[model samples]
Target: MKKRWYDYLWIASALYLILGFFNILFAWLGLLCFFLPLIISITTGSKAYCNRYCGRGQLFALLGGRFGLSRQHDIPRWMKSKWFRCGFLLFFLVMFGQMLVNTALVFSGARDLGQAVTLLWTFKLPWHWAYHGGVSPWIAQFAFGFYSVMLTSTVLGLVTMALFKPRSWCVYCPMGTMTQLICRAEYRPERKKTAC
Candidate 1:
Protein backbone atom coordinates (compact mmCIF):
# COMPACT_ATOMS: atom_id res chain seq x y z
CA MET A 1 0.00 0.00 0.00
CA LYS A 2 1.47 3.34 -1.05
CA LYS A 3 1.45 6.18 1.42
CA ARG A 4 -1.15 8.81 0.75
CA TRP A 5 -0.99 12.55 1.42
CA TYR A 6 -3.96 12.32 3.77
CA ASP A 7 -2.14 9.76 5.91
CA TYR A 8 -0.03 12.49 7.42
CA LEU A 9 -1.97 12.53 10.64
CA TRP A 10 1.25 12.06 12.56
CA ILE A 11 2.36 15.59 11.74
CA ALA A 12 -0.80 17.01 13.26
CA SER A 13 -0.32 14.76 16.27
CA ALA A 14 3.23 16.03 16.74
CA LEU A 15 2.08 19.62 16.66
CA TYR A 16 -0.65 18.89 19.20
CA LEU A 17 1.81 17.13 21.46
CA ILE A 18 3.97 20.24 21.38
CA LEU A 19 0.90 22.31 22.17
CA GLY A 20 -0.06 20.00 25.03
CA PHE A 21 3.48 20.34 26.24
CA PHE A 22 3.09 24.09 26.46
CA ASN A 23 -0.65 24.53 27.08
CA ILE A 24 -1.73 21.34 28.96
CA LEU A 25 -5.46 21.37 28.18
CA PHE A 26 -4.58 20.41 24.64
CA ALA A 27 -3.65 16.98 25.94
CA TRP A 28 -7.31 16.06 25.89
CA LEU A 29 -7.31 16.74 22.18
CA GLY A 30 -4.32 14.44 21.84
CA LEU A 31 -6.25 11.67 23.63
CA LEU A 32 -8.90 11.64 20.94
CA CYS A 33 -6.39 9.63 18.92
CA PHE A 34 -6.79 6.75 21.33
CA PHE A 35 -10.36 7.10 22.56
CA LEU A 36 -11.93 7.54 19.16
CA PRO A 37 -10.14 4.57 17.68
CA LEU A 38 -10.83 2.44 20.73
CA ILE A 39 -14.52 3.17 20.32
CA ILE A 40 -14.51 2.22 16.65
CA SER A 41 -12.49 -0.95 17.24
CA ILE A 42 -14.93 -2.15 19.89
CA THR A 43 -17.76 -2.39 17.37
CA THR A 44 -15.69 -3.75 14.50
CA GLY A 45 -13.17 -5.97 16.33
CA SER A 46 -10.48 -4.49 14.14
CA LYS A 47 -7.56 -2.19 14.79
CA ALA A 48 -9.08 0.56 12.75
CA TYR A 49 -6.79 3.15 14.30
CA CYS A 50 -3.67 1.40 13.10
CA ASN A 51 -5.15 0.89 9.70
CA ARG A 52 -6.10 4.51 9.22
CA TYR A 53 -5.21 7.17 11.79
CA CYS A 54 -2.44 6.37 14.28
CA GLY A 55 -0.02 9.24 14.09
CA ARG A 56 2.65 7.61 16.18
CA GLY A 57 2.44 4.47 14.08
CA GLN A 58 2.77 6.54 10.96
CA LEU A 59 5.84 8.20 12.41
CA PHE A 60 7.35 4.82 13.05
CA ALA A 61 6.73 3.87 9.45
CA LEU A 62 8.45 7.00 8.27
CA LEU A 63 11.39 6.35 10.49
CA GLY A 64 11.71 2.71 9.57
CA GLY A 65 10.85 2.83 5.89
CA ARG A 66 11.85 6.30 4.78
CA PHE A 67 14.97 6.44 6.89
CA GLY A 68 15.88 2.77 6.38
CA LEU A 69 15.98 2.08 10.08
CA SER A 70 13.68 -0.92 10.11
CA ARG A 71 15.34 -4.27 10.52
CA GLN A 72 12.13 -5.90 9.34
CA HIS A 73 12.73 -8.76 11.70
CA ASP A 74 9.99 -11.03 12.99
CA ILE A 75 8.78 -10.12 16.44
CA PRO A 76 9.92 -12.44 19.18
CA ARG A 77 7.34 -14.79 20.63
CA TRP A 78 7.81 -13.30 24.09
CA MET A 79 6.70 -9.91 22.80
CA LYS A 80 3.70 -11.48 21.06
CA SER A 81 2.63 -13.38 24.17
CA LYS A 82 -0.84 -12.48 25.41
CA TRP A 83 0.35 -12.51 29.00
CA PHE A 84 3.13 -10.03 28.32
CA ARG A 85 0.94 -7.79 26.20
CA CYS A 86 -1.81 -7.65 28.82
CA GLY A 87 0.68 -7.07 31.62
CA PHE A 88 2.24 -4.15 29.78
CA LEU A 89 -1.20 -2.72 29.06
CA LEU A 90 -2.11 -2.93 32.73
CA PHE A 91 1.08 -1.17 33.71
CA PHE A 92 0.57 1.54 31.11
CA LEU A 93 -3.01 2.14 32.26
CA VAL A 94 -1.95 2.46 35.88
CA MET A 95 0.68 5.03 35.00
CA PHE A 96 -1.82 6.96 32.91
CA GLY A 97 -4.32 6.99 35.77
CA GLN A 98 -1.68 8.16 38.21
CA MET A 99 -0.63 11.05 35.98
CA LEU A 100 -4.25 12.15 35.52
CA VAL A 101 -4.83 12.14 39.25
CA ASN A 102 -1.68 14.13 39.84
CA THR A 103 -2.77 16.69 37.29
CA ALA A 104 -6.30 16.82 38.71
CA LEU A 105 -5.00 17.40 42.22
CA VAL A 106 -2.88 20.30 41.09
CA PHE A 107 -5.75 21.82 39.10
CA SER A 108 -8.44 21.21 41.75
CA GLY A 109 -6.47 23.07 44.42
CA ALA A 110 -5.97 19.92 46.40
CA ARG A 111 -2.18 20.31 46.14
CA ASP A 112 0.48 22.82 45.29
CA LEU A 113 0.96 23.33 41.61
CA GLY A 114 4.09 21.49 40.69
CA GLN A 115 6.52 23.47 38.60
CA ALA A 116 7.54 22.64 35.05
CA VAL A 117 9.69 19.71 33.79
CA THR A 118 7.19 16.93 34.39
CA LEU A 119 8.09 13.22 34.20
CA LEU A 120 11.21 13.75 32.05
CA TRP A 121 10.70 16.61 29.63
CA THR A 122 14.00 18.49 29.47
CA PHE A 123 14.80 17.50 33.05
CA LYS A 124 12.52 20.16 34.55
CA LEU A 125 13.35 22.92 32.14
CA PRO A 126 10.14 24.86 31.51
CA TRP A 127 8.64 24.61 28.04
CA HIS A 128 7.43 27.47 25.84
CA TRP A 129 10.41 29.63 26.65
CA ALA A 130 8.62 32.50 24.96
CA TYR A 131 6.88 33.08 28.28
CA HIS A 132 9.86 33.68 30.52
CA GLY A 133 11.18 30.23 31.53
CA GLY A 134 8.11 28.59 30.03
CA VAL A 135 6.09 29.49 33.11
CA SER A 136 2.43 30.26 32.50
CA PRO A 137 -0.62 30.28 34.72
CA TRP A 138 -1.27 27.32 37.00
CA ILE A 139 -3.42 25.70 34.34
CA ALA A 140 -0.27 25.28 32.28
CA GLN A 141 1.11 22.87 34.83
CA PHE A 142 -1.83 20.52 34.30
CA ALA A 143 -1.12 20.57 30.61
CA PHE A 144 2.55 19.84 31.20
CA GLY A 145 1.69 16.81 33.30
CA PHE A 146 -0.62 15.51 30.60
CA TYR A 147 2.06 16.03 27.99
CA SER A 148 4.46 14.07 30.17
CA VAL A 149 2.03 11.16 30.09
CA MET A 150 1.92 11.49 26.32
CA LEU A 151 5.72 11.49 26.22
CA THR A 152 5.67 8.13 27.94
CA SER A 153 3.44 6.69 25.25
CA THR A 154 5.49 8.27 22.51
CA VAL A 155 8.72 6.83 23.86
CA LEU A 156 7.21 3.37 24.15
CA GLY A 157 5.85 3.53 20.63
CA LEU A 158 9.20 4.55 19.23
CA VAL A 159 11.08 1.87 21.11
CA THR A 160 8.59 -0.81 20.13
CA MET A 161 8.91 0.14 16.49
CA ALA A 162 12.68 0.12 16.65
CA LEU A 163 12.92 -3.24 18.36
CA PHE A 164 10.22 -5.17 16.55
CA LYS A 165 7.93 -5.03 13.56
CA PRO A 166 6.48 -1.62 12.78
CA ARG A 167 3.00 -2.61 13.90
CA SER A 168 4.16 -4.85 16.72
CA TRP A 169 3.51 -2.10 19.23
CA CYS A 170 -0.20 -2.33 18.50
CA VAL A 171 -0.37 -5.74 20.13
CA TYR A 172 0.59 -4.31 23.49
CA CYS A 173 -0.89 -0.83 23.14
CA PRO A 174 -3.20 -0.10 26.05
CA MET A 175 -5.98 1.35 23.91
CA GLY A 176 -5.72 -1.41 21.37
CA THR A 177 -5.70 -4.02 24.09
CA MET A 178 -8.74 -2.45 25.69
CA THR A 179 -10.62 -2.50 22.41
CA GLN A 180 -9.66 -6.11 21.80
CA LEU A 181 -11.02 -6.98 25.21
CA ILE A 182 -14.31 -5.21 24.54
CA CYS A 183 -14.53 -6.69 21.07
CA ARG A 184 -14.26 -10.32 21.99
CA ALA A 185 -13.82 -13.07 19.44
CA GLU A 186 -16.91 -14.63 17.91
CA TYR A 187 -18.55 -17.28 20.05
CA ARG A 188 -17.56 -20.86 19.33
CA PRO A 189 -18.62 -23.50 21.78
CA GLU A 190 -16.12 -25.99 20.42
CA ARG A 191 -13.27 -23.58 21.12
CA LYS A 192 -14.10 -23.27 24.79
CA LYS A 193 -11.50 -24.61 27.13
CA THR A 194 -12.42 -27.52 29.37
CA ALA A 195 -11.22 -27.54 32.99
CA CYS A 196 -8.49 -30.08 33.29
Candidate 2:
Protein backbone atom coordinates (compact mmCIF):
# COMPACT_ATOMS: atom_id res chain seq x y z
CA MET A 1 0.00 0.00 0.00
CA LYS A 2 1.16 3.48 -0.87
CA LYS A 3 1.71 5.25 2.44
CA ARG A 4 -0.18 8.48 2.81
CA TRP A 5 1.35 11.43 4.66
CA TYR A 6 -1.13 10.98 7.52
CA ASP A 7 -0.10 7.37 8.04
CA TYR A 8 3.10 8.52 9.65
CA LEU A 9 1.23 9.98 12.63
CA TRP A 10 -0.26 6.61 13.44
CA ILE A 11 3.14 4.97 13.09
CA ALA A 12 4.76 7.46 15.42
CA SER A 13 1.99 7.20 18.00
CA ALA A 14 2.25 3.46 17.96
CA LEU A 15 5.98 3.74 18.43
CA TYR A 16 5.43 6.06 21.37
CA LEU A 17 2.91 3.70 22.99
CA ILE A 18 5.21 0.74 22.54
CA LEU A 19 8.14 2.71 23.84
CA GLY A 20 6.16 3.66 26.93
CA PHE A 21 5.28 0.04 27.58
CA PHE A 22 8.83 -1.06 27.08
CA ASN A 23 10.04 1.71 29.33
CA ILE A 24 7.79 0.37 32.04
CA LEU A 25 8.67 -3.27 31.33
CA PHE A 26 12.25 -3.30 30.06
CA ALA A 27 13.37 0.19 31.22
CA TRP A 28 16.81 0.63 29.59
CA LEU A 29 15.56 -0.18 26.08
CA GLY A 30 12.58 2.08 26.70
CA LEU A 31 14.90 4.97 27.52
CA LEU A 32 16.59 4.52 24.16
CA CYS A 33 13.22 4.34 22.41
CA PHE A 34 12.17 7.59 24.08
CA PHE A 35 14.95 9.47 22.37
CA LEU A 36 14.49 7.81 18.99
CA PRO A 37 11.54 9.91 17.88
CA LEU A 38 13.11 13.05 19.24
CA ILE A 39 16.27 12.41 17.24
CA ILE A 40 14.25 11.67 14.12
CA SER A 41 12.13 14.76 14.52
CA ILE A 42 15.14 16.98 15.07
CA THR A 43 17.04 15.53 12.14
CA THR A 44 14.03 15.93 9.91
CA GLY A 45 11.41 18.43 11.13
CA SER A 46 8.29 18.67 13.28
CA LYS A 47 6.55 17.16 10.26
CA ALA A 48 8.42 13.98 11.07
CA TYR A 49 5.90 13.51 13.85
CA CYS A 50 3.05 16.02 13.73
CA ASN A 51 2.41 15.96 10.00
CA ARG A 52 3.04 12.29 9.45
CA TYR A 53 3.22 9.89 12.37
CA CYS A 54 1.23 11.10 15.39
CA GLY A 55 -2.05 9.24 15.87
CA ARG A 56 -3.66 12.41 17.16
CA GLY A 57 -2.47 14.30 14.12
CA GLN A 58 -3.82 11.60 11.83
CA LEU A 59 -7.20 11.83 13.51
CA PHE A 60 -7.18 15.58 13.26
CA ALA A 61 -6.25 15.50 9.58
CA LEU A 62 -8.99 13.01 8.83
CA LEU A 63 -11.62 15.02 10.64
CA GLY A 64 -10.44 18.35 9.32
CA GLY A 65 -10.16 17.03 5.80
CA ARG A 66 -13.65 15.58 5.91
CA PHE A 67 -15.12 18.73 7.45
CA GLY A 68 -13.31 21.09 5.06
CA LEU A 69 -11.52 22.63 8.03
CA SER A 70 -8.06 21.62 6.92
CA ARG A 71 -7.19 25.04 5.57
CA GLN A 72 -4.07 26.58 7.03
CA HIS A 73 -3.45 30.26 7.72
CA ASP A 74 -0.42 32.30 8.64
CA ILE A 75 0.19 32.55 12.39
CA PRO A 76 0.49 36.12 13.56
CA ARG A 77 3.88 37.23 14.81
CA TRP A 78 2.40 38.70 17.96
CA MET A 79 0.99 35.33 18.90
CA LYS A 80 4.53 33.94 18.77
CA SER A 81 6.11 36.87 20.61
CA LYS A 82 8.26 36.99 23.73
CA TRP A 83 5.23 36.92 26.05
CA PHE A 84 4.00 33.67 24.54
CA ARG A 85 7.46 32.15 24.77
CA CYS A 86 7.81 33.19 28.39
CA GLY A 87 4.37 31.85 29.24
CA PHE A 88 5.11 28.52 27.63
CA LEU A 89 8.39 28.33 29.49
CA LEU A 90 6.57 28.99 32.73
CA PHE A 91 4.07 26.27 31.92
CA PHE A 92 6.85 23.80 31.30
CA LEU A 93 8.53 24.76 34.53
CA VAL A 94 5.33 24.16 36.44
CA MET A 95 4.89 20.76 34.85
CA PHE A 96 8.46 19.86 35.72
CA GLY A 97 7.91 20.98 39.27
CA GLN A 98 4.78 18.87 39.55
CA MET A 99 6.64 15.85 38.24
CA LEU A 100 9.51 16.37 40.66
CA VAL A 101 7.18 16.84 43.58
CA ASN A 102 5.24 13.74 42.66
CA THR A 103 8.42 11.70 42.49
CA ALA A 104 9.61 13.08 45.78
CA LEU A 105 6.32 12.26 47.43
CA VAL A 106 6.36 8.72 46.12
CA PHE A 107 9.88 8.18 47.45
CA SER A 108 9.22 9.89 50.77
CA GLY A 109 6.11 7.85 51.65
CA ALA A 110 3.79 10.84 51.43
CA ARG A 111 1.79 8.56 49.22
CA ASP A 112 -1.31 10.65 48.62
CA LEU A 113 0.57 13.72 47.44
CA GLY A 114 0.39 12.68 43.82
CA GLN A 115 -3.29 11.76 43.87
CA ALA A 116 -4.20 15.02 45.54
CA VAL A 117 -2.46 16.85 42.76
CA THR A 118 -4.40 14.92 40.13
CA LEU A 119 -7.66 15.40 41.94
CA LEU A 120 -6.94 19.11 42.11
CA TRP A 121 -6.66 19.05 38.34
CA THR A 122 -9.98 17.14 38.03
CA PHE A 123 -8.45 13.88 36.80
CA LYS A 124 -10.30 11.11 38.66
CA LEU A 125 -8.94 8.03 36.93
CA PRO A 126 -7.62 5.08 38.93
CA TRP A 127 -4.06 4.85 37.74
CA HIS A 128 -3.00 1.77 39.73
CA TRP A 129 -5.65 -0.42 38.15
CA ALA A 130 -4.74 0.92 34.72
CA TYR A 131 -1.16 -0.12 35.30
CA HIS A 132 -0.11 -3.39 37.10
CA GLY A 133 -1.61 -2.41 40.47
CA GLY A 134 1.74 -2.27 42.21
CA VAL A 135 2.25 1.47 42.12
CA SER A 136 0.76 3.66 44.85
CA PRO A 137 -2.51 5.44 44.21
CA TRP A 138 -0.74 8.80 44.15
CA ILE A 139 1.70 7.68 41.52
CA ALA A 140 -1.05 6.12 39.51
CA GLN A 141 -3.12 9.29 39.57
CA PHE A 142 -0.11 11.32 38.55
CA ALA A 143 0.55 9.02 35.62
CA PHE A 144 -3.07 9.17 34.57
CA GLY A 145 -3.16 12.92 34.72
CA PHE A 146 0.14 13.18 32.92
CA TYR A 147 -1.11 11.06 30.00
CA SER A 148 -4.39 12.95 29.97
CA VAL A 149 -2.56 16.24 29.70
CA MET A 150 -0.43 14.87 26.89
CA LEU A 151 -3.49 13.77 24.96
CA THR A 152 -5.23 17.09 25.58
CA SER A 153 -2.19 19.01 24.41
CA THR A 154 -2.00 16.97 21.21
CA VAL A 155 -5.60 17.76 20.36
CA LEU A 156 -5.01 21.41 21.06
CA GLY A 157 -1.94 21.27 18.81
CA LEU A 158 -3.98 19.79 15.98
CA VAL A 159 -6.57 22.52 16.26
CA THR A 160 -3.86 25.14 16.28
CA MET A 161 -2.26 23.66 13.15
CA ALA A 162 -5.54 23.32 11.26
CA LEU A 163 -6.18 27.02 11.83
CA PHE A 164 -2.63 28.26 11.38
CA LYS A 165 -0.58 27.99 8.23
CA PRO A 166 2.81 27.18 9.68
CA ARG A 167 1.87 24.72 12.44
CA SER A 168 1.20 26.92 15.43
CA TRP A 169 1.70 24.15 17.99
CA CYS A 170 5.39 23.98 17.12
CA VAL A 171 5.84 27.46 18.52
CA TYR A 172 4.88 26.57 22.08
CA CYS A 173 5.70 22.87 22.09
CA PRO A 174 8.21 22.31 24.91
CA MET A 175 10.09 19.58 23.05
CA GLY A 176 10.09 21.58 19.83
CA THR A 177 11.29 24.63 21.71
CA MET A 178 14.20 22.64 23.14
CA THR A 179 15.09 21.06 19.79
CA GLN A 180 14.93 24.46 18.03
CA LEU A 181 17.30 25.91 20.56
CA ILE A 182 19.78 23.15 19.77
CA CYS A 183 19.25 23.47 15.99
CA ARG A 184 19.63 27.24 15.96
CA ALA A 185 23.14 26.93 17.38
CA GLU A 186 24.14 24.65 14.51
CA TYR A 187 22.00 25.92 11.62
CA ARG A 188 22.52 29.04 9.51
CA PRO A 189 19.91 30.43 7.15
CA GLU A 190 20.81 30.77 3.50
CA ARG A 191 21.24 34.30 2.22
CA LYS A 192 18.51 35.63 -0.05
CA LYS A 193 19.35 36.29 -3.71
CA THR A 194 18.90 39.83 -4.95
CA ALA A 195 18.46 40.81 -8.64
CA CYS A 196 21.06 43.21 -9.97
Candidate 3:
Protein backbone atom coordinates (compact mmCIF):
# COMPACT_ATOMS: atom_id res chain seq x y z
CA MET A 1 0.00 0.00 0.00
CA LYS A 2 1.22 3.45 -0.80
CA LYS A 3 1.84 5.69 2.21
CA ARG A 4 -0.27 8.80 2.58
CA TRP A 5 1.07 12.09 3.92
CA TYR A 6 -0.66 11.41 7.23
CA ASP A 7 1.56 8.43 7.90
CA TYR A 8 4.39 10.81 8.62
CA LEU A 9 2.40 12.15 11.54
CA TRP A 10 4.16 9.62 13.72
CA ILE A 11 7.16 11.92 13.59
CA ALA A 12 5.06 14.79 14.86
CA SER A 13 3.77 12.60 17.66
CA ALA A 14 7.30 11.76 18.75
CA LEU A 15 8.36 15.39 18.48
CA TYR A 16 5.41 16.51 20.59
CA LEU A 17 6.49 14.23 23.38
CA ILE A 18 10.06 15.51 23.19
CA LEU A 19 8.96 19.13 23.08
CA GLY A 20 6.70 18.68 26.11
CA PHE A 21 9.52 17.07 28.04
CA PHE A 22 11.80 20.04 27.46
CA ASN A 23 9.24 22.84 27.63
CA ILE A 24 5.95 21.93 29.18
CA LEU A 25 4.20 24.97 27.70
CA PHE A 26 4.27 23.10 24.43
CA ALA A 27 1.93 20.66 26.15
CA TRP A 28 -0.99 22.88 25.22
CA LEU A 29 -0.57 21.61 21.69
CA GLY A 30 -1.79 18.26 22.97
CA LEU A 31 -5.26 19.76 22.75
CA LEU A 32 -5.05 19.31 19.00
CA CYS A 33 -4.62 15.60 19.47
CA PHE A 34 -7.57 15.51 21.84
CA PHE A 35 -9.94 17.71 19.84
CA LEU A 36 -9.18 17.00 16.19
CA PRO A 37 -10.30 13.39 16.41
CA LEU A 38 -13.74 14.31 17.74
CA ILE A 39 -14.04 17.14 15.25
CA ILE A 40 -13.27 14.78 12.37
CA SER A 41 -15.61 12.08 13.64
CA ILE A 42 -18.40 14.59 14.20
CA THR A 43 -18.04 16.26 10.82
CA THR A 44 -17.43 13.11 8.76
CA GLY A 45 -19.35 10.56 10.83
CA SER A 46 -16.37 8.24 10.60
CA LYS A 47 -13.43 7.10 12.61
CA ALA A 48 -11.04 8.58 10.09
CA TYR A 49 -9.01 10.11 12.88
CA CYS A 50 -8.40 6.79 14.54
CA ASN A 51 -8.17 4.90 11.25
CA ARG A 52 -5.82 7.17 9.38
CA TYR A 53 -4.83 10.33 11.22
CA CYS A 54 -3.92 9.48 14.81
CA GLY A 55 -0.25 10.25 15.16
CA ARG A 56 0.12 8.37 18.41
CA GLY A 57 -1.38 5.27 16.85
CA GLN A 58 1.00 5.61 13.94
CA LEU A 59 3.91 5.97 16.31
CA PHE A 60 2.91 2.79 18.12
CA ALA A 61 2.68 0.94 14.82
CA LEU A 62 6.12 2.15 13.83
CA LEU A 63 7.70 1.15 17.12
CA GLY A 64 5.97 -2.18 17.59
CA GLY A 65 5.65 -3.24 13.96
CA ARG A 66 8.80 -1.93 12.28
CA PHE A 67 11.08 -1.90 15.30
CA GLY A 68 9.79 -5.28 16.50
CA LEU A 69 9.10 -4.06 20.01
CA SER A 70 5.78 -5.85 20.30
CA ARG A 71 5.43 -9.46 21.32
CA GLN A 72 2.86 -9.80 18.54
CA HIS A 73 0.52 -11.69 20.79
CA ASP A 74 -3.24 -11.31 20.76
CA ILE A 75 -4.74 -8.84 23.15
CA PRO A 76 -6.81 -10.42 25.91
CA ARG A 77 -10.38 -11.25 24.96
CA TRP A 78 -11.70 -9.43 28.00
CA MET A 79 -9.90 -6.27 27.00
CA LYS A 80 -11.60 -6.31 23.61
CA SER A 81 -15.10 -6.56 25.04
CA LYS A 82 -17.49 -3.63 24.83
CA TRP A 83 -17.94 -3.41 28.58
CA PHE A 84 -14.23 -3.00 29.16
CA ARG A 85 -13.96 -0.41 26.44
CA CYS A 86 -16.81 1.64 27.84
CA GLY A 87 -15.51 1.33 31.38
CA PHE A 88 -12.07 2.47 30.35
CA LEU A 89 -13.60 5.38 28.50
CA LEU A 90 -15.54 6.36 31.59
CA PHE A 91 -12.42 6.26 33.72
CA PHE A 92 -10.50 8.32 31.23
CA LEU A 93 -13.24 10.94 31.19
CA VAL A 94 -13.28 11.10 34.96
CA MET A 95 -9.57 11.75 35.03
CA PHE A 96 -9.96 14.43 32.41
CA GLY A 97 -12.72 16.01 34.47
CA GLN A 98 -10.45 16.10 37.49
CA MET A 99 -7.81 17.84 35.43
CA LEU A 100 -10.31 20.47 34.40
CA VAL A 101 -11.40 21.01 37.98
CA ASN A 102 -7.80 21.43 39.06
CA THR A 103 -7.20 23.97 36.35
CA ALA A 104 -10.38 25.77 37.36
CA LEU A 105 -9.22 25.89 40.93
CA VAL A 106 -5.98 27.51 39.89
CA PHE A 107 -7.79 29.96 37.69
CA SER A 108 -10.05 30.99 40.53
CA GLY A 109 -7.13 31.31 42.97
CA ALA A 110 -8.66 28.63 45.15
CA ARG A 111 -5.55 26.46 44.83
CA ASP A 112 -1.90 26.96 44.08
CA LEU A 113 -0.56 26.19 40.64
CA GLY A 114 0.65 22.63 40.38
CA GLN A 115 4.05 22.03 38.80
CA ALA A 116 4.09 18.25 38.83
CA VAL A 117 2.82 15.78 36.29
CA THR A 118 0.70 13.04 37.78
CA LEU A 119 1.39 9.83 35.96
CA LEU A 120 -1.52 7.39 35.82
CA TRP A 121 -3.21 9.72 38.30
CA THR A 122 -0.95 8.34 41.00
CA PHE A 123 2.70 9.27 40.73
CA LYS A 124 3.42 12.94 40.95
CA LEU A 125 6.64 13.52 39.10
CA PRO A 126 8.30 16.87 39.54
CA TRP A 127 8.10 18.74 36.25
CA HIS A 128 8.81 22.24 37.47
CA TRP A 129 11.91 22.71 35.36
CA ALA A 130 9.84 22.63 32.21
CA TYR A 131 7.74 25.55 33.48
CA HIS A 132 8.77 29.20 33.42
CA GLY A 133 6.81 31.66 35.52
CA GLY A 134 5.65 34.14 32.91
CA VAL A 135 2.22 32.85 32.07
CA SER A 136 -0.98 32.87 34.13
CA PRO A 137 -1.07 30.21 36.81
CA TRP A 138 -4.14 28.53 35.38
CA ILE A 139 -2.65 28.33 31.91
CA ALA A 140 0.45 26.66 33.22
CA GLN A 141 -1.62 24.41 35.44
CA PHE A 142 -3.66 23.28 32.45
CA ALA A 143 -0.46 22.58 30.56
CA PHE A 144 0.84 20.40 33.36
CA GLY A 145 -2.39 18.50 33.68
CA PHE A 146 -2.82 18.08 29.95
CA TYR A 147 0.75 16.91 29.54
CA SER A 148 0.22 14.34 32.26
CA VAL A 149 -2.80 12.98 30.43
CA MET A 150 -0.90 12.81 27.15
CA LEU A 151 2.16 11.17 28.71
CA THR A 152 0.10 8.68 30.66
CA SER A 153 -1.80 7.63 27.56
CA THR A 154 1.45 7.23 25.64
CA VAL A 155 2.90 5.10 28.41
CA LEU A 156 -0.19 2.90 28.41
CA GLY A 157 -0.03 2.59 24.63
CA LEU A 158 3.65 1.63 24.77
CA VAL A 159 3.02 -0.94 27.46
CA THR A 160 0.15 -2.48 25.54
CA MET A 161 2.13 -2.39 22.31
CA ALA A 162 5.00 -4.25 23.97
CA LEU A 163 2.69 -6.87 25.42
CA PHE A 164 0.35 -7.42 22.49
CA LYS A 165 0.18 -6.61 18.80
CA PRO A 166 1.10 -3.23 17.41
CA ARG A 167 -1.88 -0.84 17.48
CA SER A 168 -3.60 -2.98 20.10
CA TRP A 169 -4.04 0.10 22.20
CA CYS A 170 -6.45 1.33 19.57
CA VAL A 171 -8.87 -1.37 20.64
CA TYR A 172 -9.80 0.41 23.84
CA CYS A 173 -8.39 3.87 23.40
CA PRO A 174 -10.66 6.45 25.05
CA MET A 175 -10.50 8.86 22.16
CA GLY A 176 -11.20 6.07 19.72
CA THR A 177 -14.14 4.94 21.80
CA MET A 178 -15.46 8.48 22.02
CA THR A 179 -15.16 8.98 18.28
CA GLN A 180 -16.84 5.65 17.66
CA LEU A 181 -19.71 6.74 19.87
CA ILE A 182 -19.91 10.01 18.03
CA CYS A 183 -19.99 8.24 14.68
CA ARG A 184 -22.66 5.83 15.91
CA ALA A 185 -24.85 8.64 17.23
CA GLU A 186 -24.46 10.53 14.01
CA TYR A 187 -25.57 7.55 11.91
CA ARG A 188 -28.09 5.93 14.25
CA PRO A 189 -31.10 7.72 12.79
CA GLU A 190 -29.97 6.96 9.26
CA ARG A 191 -29.68 3.28 10.10
CA LYS A 192 -33.13 3.32 11.68
CA LYS A 193 -34.63 4.92 8.61
CA THR A 194 -33.03 2.39 6.28
CA ALA A 195 -34.24 -0.48 8.44
CA CYS A 196 -37.82 0.87 8.46
lDDT of 2 by residue, 35-66 (tens): 64478657764435434444644545555566
Candidates' TM-scores?
0.76, 0.59, 0.94
* lDDT of predicted model 2: 0.54
lDDT of 3 by residue, 43-64 (tens): 8899988888889999999999
Q: Show model 1 residue runs off by greater than 4 Å.
A: 1-6, 43-45, 117-141, 185-196
> Candidate 2 clashing pairs?
8-52, 8-53, 9-52, 9-53, 9-54, 73-165
Clash count of each predicted structure: 2, 6, 0
Error of 2 at 31 (Å): 7.7
Error of 2 at 187 (Å): 1.8
| Residue-wise C-alpha lDDT for candidate 1, range 58-140, written one tens digit per residue | 77788877886667777888877889879988887776777678767766777776655455333555555422334434556
lDDT of each: 0.68, 0.54, 0.93
**For candidate 1, what is the lDDT?**
0.68
Question: Which candidate gets the maximum lDDT versus the true structure?
Answer: 3
Pairs clashing within candidate 1:
24-143, 117-124
